[model samples]
Target: MDADFLLIRKMKQGEDKAFDLFVHKYYKEILTYCNYHCPNKEYAEDLTQETFVRFFAKLSDFHYRGKTKNYLYTISGNLCRDFYKKVKEIPVEAMELTEKTEPMEHQMTDVVNKLTLEWALKQLPDEFHEVLILYYFQELKLKEIADALKISLPLVKYRLKQARKQLERLLGEEEIYESGSKTCEL
Candidate 1:
């Protein structure tokens, strides 16, 4: 059996240390996922902690539907959605952003691009944004993303394609063909 199953088994047998290890392994990842939504480190940390709490509470009900990492992401996503609903965050625009230091040409361009990209990502529908974050930013495989999102493989593929197209449109890509060909590999 794989290590996932082994870890689950240990946790099921009431091994506190195993669960602690599991939490330790995924803590940083879950926090990072939350940060993609909230941007504030403290808020993301709270969301991450809540994700772990919810996951641990529902551990027995987890019937090996997918990997634990994906499950945690799903929980994190849901919590973030809830949080955003209440606060209705407005992302900062690229032009409105100030430089942190004297930036070289490449670094300035990179920062502006990243900020624009983040804003563009927010412009996308929540589902599309989630898929893009999972596939591109988090570097999850299509299949893994599918499993994590609890959707079919084809739907995941379709959403990813649509997200890329939407991003290119939002960013005003000159070469549609070249942008479409990007598979978002890490």
Candidate 2:
């Protein structure tokens, strides 16, 4: 039995608390995605609100066809696009993206490495950046990414492949592949 199916059944049965549970589960992830896309924390909060509002409004159409996370992200991604279109006049590229200050415990090398990586990601086109962030940072499955992007599975694979190649080029070196482990480490 799929736990997501059970949750959807409970939600369909008019369990008002189910929506709250769902929000609590996905709120942070949705917000993080919004912040990354919009690069403004307060506006991202509003986008997150729009995401949940749309989800609840469309609740009657909900089904267990895919993981709820996939559904939520699809909604969030669409909202992000809509928000951008609405605010198309504003040049978000000119607005500086403020990085939340992290604790100074890390060594200088680690900080530089992180900064370099962020720079590299920013240098990529939006499509490459989106695929890399969804696959690596958010830890979403390729299928989930396909569903969220509303793209075919094979296209998702191709995008991921292209993103990896671009990242290697941007990083100036390729990570050493660990055979059988499915991971590449520097």
lDDT of each: 0.79, 0.73
Quality of model 2 by C-alpha lDDT: 0.73
Over 62-142, each residue of candidate 2 has an lDDT whose tens digit, in order, gives 767856787777787788778867875444454444454755555445546655765676677777777766776566778
Per-residue lDDT of 96-146 in model 1, one digit per residue for the tens? Answer: 334467567766776666666778889999889999888765777889999
RMSD for each model, in Å, please? 4.5, 5.1
Q: Model 1 compared with the native: what TM-score? A: 0.78
RMSD of 2: 5.1
Query: Which is the leading candidate under lDDT?
Result: 1
- CA shift of 107, model 1, Å: 7.7
